[model samples]
Target: DAGVTQSPTHLIKTRGQQVTLRCSPISGHKSVSWYQQVLGQGPQFIFQYYEKEERGRGNFPDRFSARQFPNYSSELNVNALLLGDSALYLCASSPTAVYGYTFGSGTRLTVV
Candidate 1:
């Protein structure tokens, strides 16, 4: 049973570019969530998916979007990247919508 896995452990992008982050949840996990952790701040919830549907969304802008697959894997898309968007994007998963969420190491995105 692997925990949530995020891809491109690190990324470098320029302003106005777009980026896509990937995540694969643990086996048998139906729920996946995304968070953004800025330096010196907590991880901010970005999106939550259950059964391939968007269940909850954070206060991010419209440029942020995500989708879950039949296998419970998910992808986070960020359009029109900005320097402020640089952060460690994390993926979390759990058996249910409750506690027990296991998080990934995160994808550190740096914008220049």
Candidate 2:
């Protein structure tokens, strides 16, 4: 089976713009997807979508939103982007909520 995959490995955007990031979970996996990782910090939990519904969300502002498709793929959208939003947005998938996750390389977003 293929690993979790994220599109647009790198992206650039200006402040106040909106951007969308996409992810495809591994086959047969019910993804509990999760976060963003800064250069020197551990990943931050953003949201978890299981069975096509949001299960959890972190302390992020309302500008961040995400959804899972029927096919288990997911998309993260950020509106009114800020420079602070620039980071490596990671996509993680696991068979169960507590199981180990397989992570994608991430979409490196740079806000100019």
Candidate 3:
């Protein structure tokens, strides 16, 4: 009955480096989604995984990737990080087979 959980609540990275964020969905949830939120902007959908397969992705570059584990947990990875990549990386879960989500507090990422 727990809500979605994200790891490493905060992170600091340098430009050109890489970063990975983790998430664990709520119990009984089979769908997970990732989103990015800049300080003053709305959350942007990044990826959605349902039944361990990717079902949706946003406008992010190829450097952004993700995978869902057999346990339904998920990871989000970004390569060649850029200053603009600094933001809150959020994880959401839904019982919906398709879209609509409820997000976690997120792992705040800072790129210098």
The candidate maximizing lDDT is 1
Which candidate model has the greater lDDT, 2 or 3? 3
Candidate 1 runs further than 4 Å off: none
- Give the Å shift of residue 13 in candidate 2: 0.2
**Tell me, what's the RMSD of every candidate?**
0.7, 0.8, 1.1
Q: Model 1: per-residue lDDT, tens digit, 2-110?
A: 7788998999999999999999999999999999999999999999998888989999999999999999999999999999999999999988876789999999999
The full ranking of all candidates by TM-score, starting with the best, is 1, 2, 3
Candidate 3 lDDT, 1-112, residue by residue in tens: 6788999899899999999999999887889999999999999999999999999999999999999999999999999999999999999998775656778899999999
Once fitted onto the true fold, the runs of candidate 3 whose alpha carbons sit more than 4 angstroms away are none
The number of clashing residue pairs in each candidate reads 0, 0, 0
Instruction: Report RMSD for candidate 1.
Output: 0.7
Candidate 2 C-alpha lDDT tens digits along 1-112: 7899999899999999999999998887777576999999999999998888898999999999999998989999999999999999999998876577999999999999
Q: Sorted by lDDT, highest first, which candidate order results?
A: 1, 3, 2
Candidate 1: lDDT of 39? Answer: 97
Candidate 1's clash total is 0
CA shift of 56, model 2, Å: 0.5
| Best TM-score among the predictions, by candidate number | 1
